[model samples]
Target chain A: MEFFINRSYFLNKITNVSHAISPNSPNPSYSGILIFLHPDMIHLTAQDSTMAIVTEIHPGELNQLRIESTGHMIVDAKYLIEIIRHMGGKNIHVMTVGDNMIQVSDENSKFNLFTLELERFALPDIKRPENEIKISLKNIRTTVDQIAYATSEKDARTMLMGVNFRSDGKRIITAATDSYRMALNYIDGEFSQNFNVTVPVRALQEAARIFKNDDDIIQIFVNKRKIQFVSDRTLIQSTLYDGTFPDIAAVIPKNFKSMMELDASMIIPVIERGILFKDDGVAELRMNLSEKGIQIYSGASTIGNADQQVYEVFYQGEELRMAVNGEYLLQAIKALKTLGKVRIDFTGVITPFKVSDPENKDMTMLVVPMRSSY
Target chain B: MEFFINRSYFLNKITNVSHAISPNSPNPSYSGILIFLHPDMIHLTAQDSTMAIVTEIHPGELNQLRIESTGHMIVDAKYLIEIIRHMGGKNIHVMTVGDNMIQVSDENSKFNLFTLELERFALPDIKRPENEIKISLKNIRTTVDQIAYATSEKDARTMLMGVNFRSDGKRIITAATDSYRMALNYIDGEFSQNFNVTVPVRALQEAARIFKNDDDIIQIFVNKRKIQFVSDRTLIQSTLYDGTFPDIAAVIPKNFKSMMELDASMIIPVIERGILFKDDGVAELRMNLSEKGIQIYSGASTIGNADQQVYEVFYQGEELRMAVNGEYLLQAIKALKTLGKVRIDFTGVITPFKVSDPENKDMTMLVVPMRSSY
Candidate 1:
């Protein structure tokens, strides 16, 4: 495209879209960022088949723009980004000199890069989808933060790599699990249609980062194959996984024989101390409740052992003994927002237990106990 | 060993020595730091065969020490560093509990770790050589800063991976090269015996970091296989590379055909500007000197080019044209400590060139030119 703009303004716009460009894409054209120059603004688009990002830069007071011609071209994302960042100048002039080369220059430095054919680049069509849902930006970001980490990273189980979003008429629930532990976040919202969809955790993380500055509502368009999150100046589209998500709601335990309330920080250090030794894949938590307080002891035989931790808790049940993965317990403790106390439910030695912050009832974490061979 | 000391005090001492411990050592005990607690002070030592560091922590200020036990043990570096950092307490009590287990605890947390046998660790039997040389710490640190970056990192040529120290009757010169470029620094010092030795670059870096507090004088004990740098509280021992270092003095060009004097900052931006291009390994400098001022032009083919950077310079010869790697030129420019003009001497298009600040002759940089097919 034939355009002249400030170096930093153009650099920032290209960087935002460049995150979606992959160097080793099967389609050669997908390795470049599509640039469209109009009369008043320039648009940049980058996609790697799975995720796409589109950003528009409007000429402002600092970014004065002059458009001599309107054209479209795809330039290599990695080289172009590096060239612009290292080109030392405040104002840079960019123009399409010929059919294949783009010229970028300033007072002391200039760069001419070969451009790929625009027709070969895969720019996703942005027509309005049939199924559209509107949600609050804050709620989406918070829900993604809470559940995204629990999603399985391995591709052996395709469906487990995504977080499932289920919306009834009034409230929306988000759950993620790798078949080991599950994280659930519930938010209040209004939905015109009842729908359930699985969105990839990587895409959700990118959406959260792009939506950080946007305070307005985000409109989501979902079809059978793709989902698009659109704001005012930014649009992020991601492909949907073609697998059925496991029914994790049924796996969450609802009944407990005994429960205890203890400070989250107090229990976190105790678990960390205990993780030093036990090599059998299980960390035993022996809890003794007396009139004074609750004492939690965990030990590992092969590495060493740890003791000397006491936490104040409210418990009326008999002394309970359970063994679970220390990493799972640490994750559950970290998910609690408030540091006051965490209410942990114990269903038997083998059943799944739930951990939740006493002040907030909307979030719950469940961890399946490891079978102790000892 | 039994001791009660501040947690931060022990953590700092361990961290200083832990850099020398290598987890992939042939002997498993070498992966741990040796701890020797006597009645007066506790000494910690770690070695990876290439470099070794020893630090001592004395008793008294914070807590009363019960010297009921005196022994030596080797603890894993990674686990000990992590535990000491995460254990949140001012005073931590450490004692040898059983055969190979040590108990580390405070009021809130306790950790027991399995220690390796002290007999399995290889503590280098290093003694201070009879005939040794001593140099000011300030001079040694300055010499290291000047030449360490030019040391070759490739292990194929072991001798190039070290900085060669040449001491005559009155002066000590340090030089390093990676076959492409070389840096040499000459400093005035008193030596009892003239000798030349090569020390590993990594050991020099560690010595520089450890002696950052500017000790008065550092004693250097050099043997056939080892070199020891001794200070008041620290002893840094490193193995010497056996291969003979190349004679770098022969590569330095003693005479020049053309010379030019210009400000160091002027050439810095030009080199920075030339780095924007994908190709064009060497930045060409064409100087056209007439009755008017000098004009310097630098350009890259794939990237655009720049022209007409006029600077007032006194040229000693006819119009000169030369090209050098932009990175090498930038390095030479940065090594100039003074803010005034720098003198650059060129022999020919392919021969080596030298650059030095006009005020000081102690520091000089020699760069070999990259052959250009064109």
Candidate 2:
């Protein structure tokens, strides 16, 4: 393979594809990036067993890309990126020097990197699925960020480690639950057909990173085995989990014993301080509401105690007290801070409570209360 | 104890004192900060046996410091700082609420922190030594930064973990070494009495952090057992290590077979990239200097090889080749990058080479060449 390209432009492509490269991948082929140089374009591919990322660079887009020969080489991803990034020159020259070595050089530095044989490289099979759904990057990113945090980090329940995306020809609903809490987001979109798939939370986060602007629309192609998020120059494909997600929509209660509205800016800092006094192993916090306002308190036998009061909140229904996981509530409140104000509805001491933005009705966050010996 | 102070100002003082606190201290008294409130000023102190930092806040310095009642309290350093820093109000009100509890409150939050009994608190003894020497903060800080990196991290030779500061009533010489490499710095300062002390590198680092401006002069109070760095509002006292530093000045050879000069900006980046191909367990780099230029190269059997050449250099030495630890050379070169150009003197392939700024004769860095199979 021989090519001369702008150092910075090539470095950006390597970094985008490196997102999927796992250093500890057992297969030697998976540890390097496969660079394919065609007559008009260059494609960089990197993948682990479960996910793959491919980025393409065309000659017309960047006038600096000058192709000398059409060939392919799989170079160690880590070393390749480091050499390219640390080089001082504006352009880099890459050419095959020996049977299994390629020379990457700039004005001052030259690196001879060993390349993996093409016969051993495990190239990912990428195909555009027949069923494709188009959605704005802004809407999809919001949906993923709102619900992905609630996914289970533990592998006990493999399905819970992913966020469930289900569409019914009219609206797309996403839900994530780690048993203790659940986050759900609903968005209106036109769908080609009905589909439900659980994509790994980590994969969704990586795909969300490709959304740089609200104006760029992304096309997501899905099948029974894999789902791919396709952008203008990049594509991220992830495999699906093989279990059914729990039916959690039935649990969103319609009635509550008490509800309160709070300014997100006013309450987030108070909870952040109050949680510092939480018990050593448990983030248990007690919140009380009355006609005056809301009060939150937490105490650890060895670490002292903290109390914070917000007197500007608007409360209705009956005065209530509930024990909750402070970290969960804090995260939900922080995520909703962009909405300015949020409303929280509580049923009883033992039931789950719901929090939502008063201005937006599509996003809902639910948390189960912990038992307190008050 | 009851007092109200500006939250931001108090937080800054707490943070400064917290640098000396160790969380896993065996003595409970050393884990908390002792706050002493006198009629004129308030002093905050935190110590971990070996090092102590005391900062004083006077009423006039910060007009927000209002002494309602004069008393003292010992609170957990970590918790106290967190609560004070997270509070939203401009001014924080602190008052004793119970026998061993103090209520630290702002307009929105209240924290009842458990304080250690004053009797158990190990108040650091900070008495200015009789022998006092004044030095610019800039000079001392520069001396520490230049030599501290060469100090031994291993405890096998306890004295090598400290930097030796010796003065002959006219000039102060600082030297630090871990056997393989040594860094020496010389600065002129007037002294009332001749003194030689080896202070722990860790302690010196903490003391150096207090030097914010070049114009500020710091007083060093030294005695047989302890050394203290005093500024206007803060004082850092550390116990002197009980051992004698080696006389390394005799080891710096004045004779050299070859010498070369290179631009710091040009060669530092080359070495940084060449070291990427270093051996797995060793940062071994090979350098060749001749009439052509300076060429550096390194290789690992499994990670490939890299070569970097610096053409813009003035050489006065015969053809020479040597192998040295890349990381050590890189660090010394990086530290001297501020000096535009650096001169390197090589005695032989196996002898210790020296690196220094051609303009500044006071600072010198020497590294031993490693044995390598060509």
Candidate 3:
């Protein structure tokens, strides 16, 4: 394709689309980015088979965009990005050099990169025919961001590695769990039809990056095997998980024997310091409740132990001692970053404890307590 | 040992000392930092067997440093640093909790770290006698910085991996080479004794870090087997390279057939962009001189080539063309960062070429030209 466009605008859009290309795709062409130059707009697409991202560039938005020739080609994503990154000057021209070769040039440097056969590259069939759920990009991002961390990256049960999206014509719930911990978030959205789809956590994370703006409206379209998230100029389609997500209400404890409301400012740093004295590989911090407050400690045989007393907590019921992975606790606390107070509910020692923000009832985190000797 | 000191001050001094603690040290105690609480001051030492660093913490610098028990203890460097880093509030107290146990506590957190046996830790014997080369830390750092990049990290020729320092009671010369290229820098300093010593590149780099101030005086003491770089509050001694360094003056061309004076700002980015289109593995950039300025190009078989015209270069003599690794050229340019203009001198097509800053006559670079198939 032959096109002359603003160097910076073209570079940013290309970079965002290039992230979808899998680094180690067996099919060489699948690791390439498809660039299509139309009369009105430029279309860029990259897919790793599982997740695909497409960004549209309108010629009017750029400093100078002129389509000398209209065509399509698939080029190596990494090589194209590198060439543009180093090619200096304010304005750059990208055009077809020869058969299956593209030249990107500025004032100082002209870089010619060989392209893969366009016909060999198979892009995912991504489309949004009719939307089942219509949600603001801001709400979608918040729901995904709060629960994405709880999803397991490399679980044998593939369903646990994805974020579950469940809608019932009115309210939409997104939940992610890895057996050890679970995070659930609720978003108010209008859904015309009932839908349940599990999008891979990585795909959601990558797709959210495209929705950097808050005012963008996103339409969610679901089929039997794929789900498409389409904004104004960006569309991302991800393969759906075949298996069902774990029921969140079933795992959460119905009744808690004791509960502690802790200040976010007080508990975060205490656990941070206590976690420093944690054992290798497994970071376990024990929360011991006394009449005074909560005494948190991390123990080891050779590295000694760290014990800190947290003052700002309202504890009731009998004295309790529970242990959980320090990293899990820190993540949950950080995920609910804007919360003024964090409420932690404990049910016995081995039972899972739930952490939630008092201000935001929509977000909840359940962490399975580790087996403690003390 | 027991002492109460400012948390940040202790952290900074310990972190500096911990750099000398090499991981997987054969002697377990060697991996631990020895904290000695003397009656007047605190001493910290860490040794990797090859290199040892000793830093003194004067009592006057701390808010309150009292030695209740004047003794020494060896504690794991990484663990001790981590504990102090997270311990909240200021004015921390470090004391021997029990036998072979150290307790560091602040207002919020109390960390107990188990210590190695004090008797087993053996520190390096480093001392400075009457007369030696005493150079300003700034000058030493400048000389090392200019030539240090030329040293090979894993050269079979061991001496090529170290920076050679030579003095003739007038000017101190520092040179490093890896057979492919060489960098030499001269510093004007008065030396009482004529000496020559080759210090390992890693040691010079580590020693340079301890000299954070330009005014700090660096005293160089050399024995047959060890070279000690003693700065204020910090003493770092490293084993000497037993091999002889190559003569840098011998490789530098005495006469030149053609020369080009290139602007640092203009030439650096042009070569950077040209190098992006370089051939696989080795980056070779050809410098072609025509009646019009200088043309730099980097080529590849399938990826095409990048050719850029630089107009700010002043050319002389016959039209000459030579090839050199782009990475080597970039490193020499970056190391002499203060120079506004860089001059390139060439003797022939395949002979060694020199790049020197026109403003700084003390620094010189020698690059062996590649056999160009131009």
CAPRI rating of model 2: medium
Q: Put the candidates in TM-score order, highest first.
A: 3, 2, 1
Best model number under lDDT: 2
**How is the predicted docking of candidate 1 categorized under the CAPRI scheme?**
acceptable
Displacement of residue B365 (Cα, Å) in model 2 is 1.8
Looking at model 2 chain A, which ten-residue stretch has the lowest summed lDDT? A331-340
lDDT of 1 by residue, B139-250 (tens): 7787677777778878688888888887756778888888778888887666688878888877777777776556568888886678888776788889888877876765
TM-score of chain B for predicted candidate 3: 0.94
Model 3 has an lDDT value of 0.81
Q: Against the true structure, what is each candidate's TM-score?
A: 0.89, 0.95, 0.95
RMSD of each: 3.7, 2.2, 2.2
| Candidate achieving higher lDDT, 1 or 2 | 2
Native contact fraction (fnat) of model 3:
0.82
Candidate 2: the clashing residue pairs are none
- Model 3 over residues B68-173: C-alpha lDDT tens digits? 6788888898888877887677888888977978888877677888898767787677766444677777877776678888998887788788888887557888
Query: Which scores higher on TM-score, 1 or 2?
Result: 2
lDDT of candidate 1 at residue A101, scale 0 to 100: 80
DockQ values for all predictions?
0.43, 0.74, 0.68
Ranking by lDDT: 2, 3, 1
Winner on lDDT (2 vs 3): 2
